[model samples]
Target: MRQAMYGLVLYVFLMLPPVANLAESVMTIHMHMQMPLFVIAGMLMTPFLKQQFPRFFAKWNSNGVPGIILFMIVVIYWMIPRTMDEALTIQAIEIFKFISLPFLAGVPLRDSWKKIRLVGKNIIFVTLSVICGFMAWLYIFSPEQLCNNYLIVEQITLGWAFLFLALSIMIYFVQQFFVDRSECE
Candidate 1:
């Protein structure tokens, strides 16, 4: 309950006009930092949401695959540069970004993480890493700017960031093979 309240607070704080504007001012911040925070807020509130809608979760996401799919869909949608532009220019899309990131992406991620097996987790990480790598390559090599709101330099910077992200995820995936999580537990 306390965590839920904090999440709610974070949700509200991020929605504030000044805060939103500042965060969105930089393309990298908008895509990487601000967006992830929204997901985190939703994850923080998962306990309360699950408590209130236990049956819904159980019925709809029995094996966590459905929730994980939903999470992936939301994540992939946001990864598109056009979608980010649409979110900025269109009020409805922006609203959807807020709602989907937290409720669809964040909540499901938290709920599905424990229910999913290691193989499923590995698949998700690999898929996301590959996607990130592709996006990085696209952003870095494309001759024209992908996003209308941001400059080519910002796009390249974001591409480098995504490249780093891909590398980090790969590193984590490789490290997992060496570390016995069961022993740590």
Candidate 2:
């Protein structure tokens, strides 16, 4: 657990400069807020999950559903977008790579539907909280910049974000189903 936390911290610190630059260029407080929030939320959730689902955490397979879905989403977006800006595309690719830790920790720890639902609820709460915080930040810190035209915020597009969330929920359900079948033996 310590190692995992260290790795996550290291990953964030290493990626901070690029992400900060992206936020600066985009002038999107939300992007900056979400980056750290997502990392911290994922990290904090790990121990709670381990405690809640000890059996699942005991045999962690290192294969994660969230990481896979994140990767695929980035790839698909890159392929389909009419004109992908090089910097944003590169940043998304890198961010997707860095998100692997949470996914790896999440997948095999889903030994039951109840636990899966709990995780999903946590994720939703984290995401929504971050969004709200970002909104507040924007209102208080840079109200004028909110309407800037040159600021190209690279947020999770509305459709894509929903899809990603759905995929995660589905993965949890699938994991639960498999675990249930195996336990029957």
Candidate with best lDDT: 1
Q: What is the alpha-carbon lDDT for the whole of candidate 2?
A: 0.44
Task: List clash counts for every candidate, in order.
Answer: 0, 0
Best by TM-score: 1
Tens-digit lDDT track for model 2 on 49-162?
Answer: 567776664454233444334433443343222212333446665455345423432322332223334565456445544444444443344424333323323333322443
Across 4-93, the per-residue lDDT of candidate 1 in tens digits comes to 999999999999999999999999999999999999999999999999999999998889999999999999999999999998999999
For each candidate, C-alpha RMSD in Å?
0.8, 13.1
| Residue pairs in candidate 2 whose N, alpha carbon or C atoms collide under 3 angstroms | none
Candidate 2 RMSD to the correct structure: 13.1
RMSD, candidate 1, Å: 0.8
lDDT value, residue 117 of candidate 2 = 47
